[model samples]
Target: MSKVGIIGAGLSGLTLALALHQQSIPSIIYESRPDAPLNIGGAVMLSPNALRVLDRLGVYERIRTRGYTFTKVDYRNAVTDTVTEMQEFGGKDKYGYDALRIYRSELIDVLLEMLEAAGVSIKYGRKFAKVLEETERQVTWEFTDGSRETAQLLVGADGIHSTVRKYLYPDLVPKFTGLAGITAAVPTAQLQAPVDLHLPLTYVLPGKGGFVIAPQQVDGSEQLIGKQRRVEKDLTREEWAAFMADKESQVKFLQDIDPAFPEVVHRAVSNIPHDKINVWPFYVVPRLNAWSSEDQHRRVVILGDAAHAIPPSAGQGINQAFEDVYMLSLLLSDTAKENNKDYLAASLKWWQESRQARVDQVLELNKQIDLRRLPQSQDSDGLEKLNFEVGWLYDIDLDQVVGNWLKEFQ
Candidate 1:
């Protein structure tokens, strides 16, 4: 059987490993972090687009048990305390699946368990440092620990700062979107539960200088979720705190909004400090001229964030990476069967051509979202414009979206 080496054990890498394992394809995953669980952030809104992939991976039900489902979304402007837009998610439960608000850790645990049950091996602390292609038949990877291994193909699922991407496209770098967002999970007991916490999975209140409020149920318990307004790039902790400290300015703007909404916002601004929030510096890499290397002798590929990094505005980052795993597996299963080296090289080329265009479109949409959320005047018209654009983003379907993307590869 042909061997595959995947860099990064994140959502993308692990999902790819599981999909490959389903075909009885063997692969090893190398993660740079210590062999321990790290708390990266609080919760995430998993739309049905991503849920479909989890279903195929056989862990959807497990995740659902630990998450909360809701059927509607509300968008409001904090400055004037006006309701900007409210949309029904077409009633997800009516369609047999509902959108979910889940703790990030719970989602990771589910993915990790599914991978292990399939006997997939993941080596932590094995940082990807370099890739060296030997003779036409094999490729070797150099790790931070001075260890090396060769395989028929190398997959760079390493995330935003992918070492594989650096080795392949050294000149390209992830450009910060000048937008910094902060997120944290506080206990449900802290907030007065929504009148119908069980009905709506999330509530987003957009604020000036780039802020949003999302209420999610992580473990069937309500949690007050808050995110800072989007900025141009990453912010220092001090800068984030300073923005939150502008109490008079924020209160003057938000005091009249629905009592429940501002109560949550006021508590968020007053209670949570920058140190307590998980702030991700938003960045993206536009589609490149080519996502694969030349020469039939060596076969190395990039998947997920390593190839295309999208901001969280669209919530498609994980789902798109899952799409990458699914399509790549389909191509490789047909060509790399029985360890056929010649077929492996041809398969990767097809994978690249098939996935690049679609990935680029997703990236573009995220950029559009980031741009639309910039600080706007405290007027209903401006907020209305923002809502029109934000609605377009949350309403995308991953399976159909990516299916058209892979049509060419077929």
Candidate 2:
């Protein structure tokens, strides 16, 4: 069997490596960052679908013990200071798993631990420079350090600014969504809001701005993951500095939305160190014509944000990445089992055919959710629409899909 070269040891890359390992496939991961276990960004919501994949990878139990699980989502009107809608999170009953909120760093740590236990090789600081060459059977990747590695197949999970994606399709680029977000995590007890701290809440001021507060546990400390988004786009460094420096203005902005909103904002801004607060613009990869190279050998394929980057507003970015990992790993496993000359190409074709439509649907659904969440929308139909979409997303069983695909090959 040929060794697989995976770029970027992110959620998708690590998951793919683990999935391949389950089938006894050998693979190596190349991470650009120098840190062995990189810790960046805020919390991520793992829907039942994501949790199911994690469970299969044998790490869900560990994550669940470290993360926060919630069964309800409260949608509150930031202007009116009232709960506009409430929905029950359908986890075990609907999808046979629980929804979880875990910090991005915590999730990375868990994945790293599992990878180490499995004896997977991950070379850090190996920044991928470009593809040096590709033959009929293998592709060679060059690193910024002038080092090079060759593999039968290359998978790019390098994220939005993926160098592999650029190497394959030079014309494609991620587009900014004309929105800016500020995210921080603070102790839940520090929040002065009068809402149930146990449940997740989304406060919408409509068009002006909005935020979400979800309970999470990071490094054994009970914390509240807070995220605020507004229509500001292409924010400069000085603008971000000004925004962060004016803490009172931020509190007042939230206070004007609703009295309770200020409390959450205050807790996030005051309690969290200034450097920990992240303020940046959001970008999404435009729908791509192809997610894999045109090489007849199928030498290169991109997954996760490298293939389909979506805005964070939908909360489906990481979830969809997990889906990508599950499907690709299964397809690759099937290819390895068959040992057919064209199996790799056939498997890559099947993987894309199975995943592209689903990715398109999620992308459109995310856009709709973003619009519905805005304050200016007069329609109250977002709740029903969101519930339907959530069910559709979280209820999928990738194991069954993979089984059906295998039966076709058999």
Say which candidate scores most in lDDT.
2
Q: Model 2, 204-287: lDDT tens per residue? A: 666654676667773324454455455546555587578766655544443343444545655654555444455546777887
Task: Please provide TM-scores, in order, for all candidate models, with all chains considered together.
Answer: 0.77, 0.86
Q: What local lDDT score does residue 317 receive in model 2, on the 0 to 100 scale? A: 86
Give candidate 1's whole-model lDDT. 0.63
Candidate 1 Cα RMSD (Å): 5.5
How accurate locally, in lDDT, is each candidate? 0.63, 0.73
- lDDT string for model 1 (28-127, tens) is 9988988843446567666655666667768788988786676555555555545555544324544446777777788788878888788888988888
Q: Which stretches of candidate 1 lie over 4 Å from their true place?
A: 37-39, 79-82, 87-96, 193-210, 218-220, 229-261, 268-270, 273-276, 295-298, 336-350, 364-372, 375-410
Question: So what's the TM-score on candidate 2?
Answer: 0.86
